[model samples]
Target: MNMLDYIDWRGDLTFEQDGFNEVDNLVFSELAYTDMRDIVPEDGSRALTVAQVYGEYKAAGIDQSLMMNDPLPVLEKAAQSPRFKDITVKWYVDKIDTEQHLQFAAVTFIISDKLAYVAFRGTDNTIVGWREDFNISFLSETPGQTEAVAYVNRIAKLTDCKLIVGGHSKGGNFAVYACAFCDKDISEKRVIKIYTNDGPGFMNEVAESENYLSILSKTIKISPDSSPVGLFFLSKAERKVIKSDSKGFMQHNPYKWHVLGAEFESADARTDPFINMTISSWLNTMTDSNKKILVDYIFDSLEASGVTSFNELADNKWNSFNSIFKALTKIDPNDKTDIASSIKKLIASGKDVVISEKQKNAEIKKAEKNKVDNEKQE
Candidate 1:
């Protein structure tokens, strides 16, 4: 069973009776993608119940199915369910800035007077959103992450209620960042738990910082056992690996994640992190300047192709491919040459990293064998 099914089974119980579980964390995290612009107040002066929000959503012709991997059907059911129907949502913020290379959205679910969940929306259909995700490797803080800290601090300031920060994917990265860097009063006092549901990790610099370490005890990182996104830039910290109904990367979808009653179905462990580690090591090999050039070139190629949303790649595949191929003619020759050179260097760097890792592993294995042989002889 997944989140939608879990709602069918357990949606009747109130937070008072059941308390906020990881399942609840994900439900709210997923719903943060809902475009609440005018229906949900940005000022937090007023709020609307999930049912009422659904009505407004319908009236406004808001179709969330346009967004990538978004689950609007779940929201429809959530509106009808007893547990989530009356939950108030407020302080919705969605920002997309091409100049800043940003895509960020968040909404606060006021569960009760004493408790609230601040859920950040993850990567959407926007190219800018994906660009910000890539920026995570080279930049200390992506624009979305910076905004997240401010949003969390602002929400935490407005109420005395304890806050639970959560997000799926890029939003998960934001949730961790906001909780880690929020005001001392809010981080140490108001924020109770932070959940990053299959969210990618940060650069080693940010991951190793004191601010991030301070909230380690309060952080809950959960991922599908076969996760492709969450495993990227792999953080060595413990994560609760959950079983998924889908195979491979598609399991990144929260709805496909299996739920066993109130909790996710557990896996023995995550799938091997070898591929993820190699990608991380490859990125680490590049200087920040080189990383920026590659990041910009990739996104620039998408923009040159006139692709605005990722949905276009799926909905109109042949046309999108044709456009992408045609876009190469429009690129400046110098930029193309630069990108090609970067790729050549990347191939060389990747080979060295893999060879070094294999040799290190072989040494460890040889040492272990020698120790075992000596012990057996004795």
Candidate 2:
């Protein structure tokens, strides 16, 4: 069973009954992805209770199609639960800038009178959101992270309650950034835990910062066994690998995560060494500037297609592919060559890791065969 099932089973139980578990973390993290713009007050100076949001949502007769598809069901389920129905949700913020390649969203949930969870929205379907994600690899601070820090500080000042910061994917990265770099007084005194679910790590410089180290112990990082995004860059936090029903990169979806009882089903370790190796090798080979250039060109090409969201681009796959191909043709020859070469190197790295693993397995099989032969001879 996954988070939705868990909620149905335990919906009647309050935090006083079951206490907050990892399953609740996943629920809150997933809830962050909901588009709360309409439900939230324009000034965001006041908080809205979850029951109030649900009432408003139903009153407006807003279709599920208008909401983010994955989180819509989760939100509906959470709103139905007595445990979470009365939670006060506020400080909703969503910002996007195509020119700056920035996308950021966050909301605060006052789970109890004394406890609050600040859930940062992860990378959305927008091309700009994906671009900002790529920028994390090279830039010291992306616009999303900057805004996240400010948001946390603002929320902290507005309330004296303990804060739990968290997000899934890019949102997770923002949670970590806000927890680490927000006002030290607030982080030290009020912030309790930071949760990052399948979130990518920061650049080496940021990872080594004093701010990061200060709150490192309170950080809890969870990734699916076959995670690609979570394994990107350098992570000093020990990961709690969880089992997933989905294969390959599709495992990045939190809905695919397996849960039993009040916690996620755990995996002993990550399952995709080849993918991890290929990404690590490719990232190591490219300079920060070159990585930025390739990412920029790729997304710029997508923008040329006149599609803003991934769903739009994906719905018209052929046209999107053609637009990307045409845009590639328009790029400088040097950049084209570099991008091609980088892709080739990534492919080679994957091939090498796969072959190495196969050889190792073969050797193990041969050794087992020889041992059996020796036993027979004896």
RMSD vs true structure, all candidates: 13.6, 11.5
> Global lDDT for candidate 1?
0.81
Candidate 1 similarity to native, TM-score: 0.84
Against the true structure, candidate 2 reaches a TM-score of 0.86
Candidate 1 regions with alpha-carbon error over 4 angstroms: 234-236, 272-281, 315-378
Q: Can you give the TM-score per candidate against the true fold?
A: 0.84, 0.86
lDDT of 1 at 15: 86
CA lDDT, every model vs. true structure: 0.81, 0.80
Q: Which stretches of candidate 2 lie over 4 Å from their true place?
A: 61-69, 273-278, 330-337, 343-378
Instruction: Estimate, for each residue in 283-347, the C-alpha lDDT of model 2 and write its tens digit.
Output: 76678977887677667877988878765654565686676667656767776665676655543
